[model samples]
Target: MAEEEAVKLFGTWRSPFSRRVEIALKLKGVDFKYYEEDLTNKSHLLLKYNPVHKKIPVLVHNEKPIVESLVILEYIDETWKEGFPILPKDPCQRSHARFWARFLDEKCLPAIEEACLRSVDREKAVEEACELLKLLENELKDNKFFGGETIGLVDIVASVISCWLKAFQQVAGVELLTKEKLPKLCEWSDEFVSHAVIKGCLPPSDKLLASLRAHFETVASKELCT
Candidate 1:
């Protein structure tokens, strides 16, 4: 690829969705220009690149924009067709991978957010989130990662669980990710964050905790005033 043909990824560092794309690009040995988007004040480039969603993590490849993290990841895999493969070659396995990824995003993520944000009935929300976590634990049954021994698409998609959720819990003063409570998930978290590429992608824990704390303060203040 020529210098001008290089990939350009518009993202915010704290966003798991954005980080997913970043890690996949690094894993695939694809060089990209990372343009960190100011999510509160979204850049014109981001709007121009992904006018529809106007979301961070829009990937600009050869001036063509790809929105949505999963779509961008798939595009990267297909376009490069080299280095490590994100999705499996086997159709059945690939489908299963997609299924788990969807489950995490659709079911688990919402439950987690509810558990953290719902000050009233938060215990109930936490219980629901735990059940979802158990379902996820079952998904991880004997594998080191959701996608078997190696970290693949499902693992990449669930990076939030491994990297940021604990910090969010700390800031929110919630207890969704206790080691004794969710042993398997806890074990996976430790392993995932420690992986070479993943470690590089994760923002430092203290820095992330500070960010989450400030966010929660704003949320709490709003609730109190309202």
Candidate 2:
């Protein structure tokens, strides 16, 4: 790929989904220039490229825009088939990887956030999140990483658990992932954050804590006043 080919990524600084694509590109040795979009004031280019969802973490390669982080990850893997393939080679394992990735994004992350926020249905939220997390814990029991020995697509998608979840847990003043309760999951989180490519982009705990605390307070005030 020529320098002028200009792989451009539109994303926010703290977004794990964006980081997923970014890390995938780096792992594949693809050079990309990043545009940090202010989510408060989304860019016209982002709107033009990803009109339907109008979301950040859009990947523009060779003047083509790919929306949704998971889809973008697959695109990156297939396009640059040179190093560290994200998905497994076997058909069955590939499907399993995709399934778990979707499960984390669509199910586990939401439940975990809801449990942390405890905004409504607190008990149900906590139970649901714990159940999902237990499944993940079992998967990680015999493996070093979600992908066995190294970080893969599922590991990339699960990155939020290591960084954002810790920040959110503190801000929400909740105790969901304790070292004793979820030791394996906690261990995986620590390992993930300590990994080289992931460590660089992991958000500062203090920064996220402040931001999330302010956001929760604002939301809480709105709820109380209403």
Candidate 3:
């Protein structure tokens, strides 16, 4: 790709979905311009590009818009399949990887959201979240990454869990990824965040914590009032 090849990314820094595409692009050595969208007052370009979702993390390659983080991820992998392949090539292995990725996206992510953002039953929410984390820890015990040795499809989807888990821990005043209880999971998190691409894509820890704290306070106050 030429330096002048038009590749633009519309995303929000705070969104994990957006961060996934950003990290994938960086890892694949794709040169692109990033436009941070204020979701409240979304830009005309964003709406025009992704008319369906009006969401961030829309990748424009050669002026073609690709919406949805997972879709964009697969697009990136296919477009730049030669270098830094995010999905495995083997059919059976790839299917298994996709299954785990979908599991995290569907089951694990919703559980975390309910625990941290919506559920009135805090204890039950925590228990549900812990169960999900326990499952993840068990999965990682025998593999260095979700793809065994290298970070792949499942790892990317699972990355959302780690980011939210950290922020939720701070806001919920709980420790789930403990060194003693989930040593491997904690280690996997450490390794994932330490990766150059992920490290660069993540928002500053202080900023993320402050944002999460503010959100939690607002939600808790609303619950108390009702």
Candidate 4:
């Protein structure tokens, strides 16, 4: 395939979904072009490739576009099989990984967002977030990573918590994830971010904090105006 036609990723820096795809590609040693999208004024190509949602982290390979980060991760893994595997070879283990990844999206993320944004029921949001984190903490149960001894699909999917959640909590004045509350998960976060591939993918800490702070404040002001 021609270099330009091989692989291209449309993504934004602040999006964990985007970063997960980048990390998966790097893990598989796939060389690709990255187009950073201006979400506020999304590019024509982004919309054309992902018109259904128009969200980023789209992976276009050989003229075929793969939307949704989880699906993109699996595509990158299946297409590039020369390197470390992202999903487990065993069907049962692979299903387990997919289950937790879904829980992170469908259950955990919403609660965390509610708590961070300080919505109408702040205390309930925080409690639900903590409960979900505890379940993840139990799941970890002494594994080095969610993938067991190496970064896998779950770790990549949970990168938002490892790299972005603490900063978001600090900016929003919420502390749902803490050493005191969930020690094993906290340790996993440290290991996940400190991993060489993940470290390279993360935005700088100060920059992420500033951006999250500004985003939260803007949301708060808008709520007050309403």
Report, for every candidate in turn, its global Cα lDDT versus the true structure. 0.87, 0.86, 0.82, 0.90
Off by over 4 Å in 4: 2-5
Per-model TM values vs. the true structure: 0.96, 0.94, 0.92, 0.96
Could you arrange the candidates by lDDT from highest to lowest?
4, 1, 2, 3
The sequence of per-residue lDDT tens digits that candidate 2 reaches over residues 1-226 is 6942579999987788988888888878888889999988999999999999999899998889999999999999888888888988888988989999999999999998788776777888888888898888888867878888888889999988888888887877676677877888898888888888788777777877888888889888998998
- Per-residue lDDT over 1-226 for candidate 3, one digit per residue giving the tens place of the 0 to 100 score: 6732688999988888888988888888888999999988999999999999788889999889999888898999989877898988998987877777777888888887777776567678868877887887787767789877888877787777667678877777766667877788888888888887888888887898888898888888998899
Query: What's the CA error at residue 214 for candidate 2, in Å?
Result: 1.7
Backbone clash pairs for candidate 3 read none
How high a TM-score does candidate 3 get? 0.92
* Of candidates 4 and 2, the better by TM-score: 4
Model 4 agreement with the true structure over 12-76: per-residue lDDT tens digits? 99899999999998888788999999999999999998999999989999878999999999988
In candidate 1, which residue pairs clash? none
User: Which one is best on TM-score?
Assistant: 4
User: Is candidate 1 or 3 superior in lDDT?
Assistant: 1
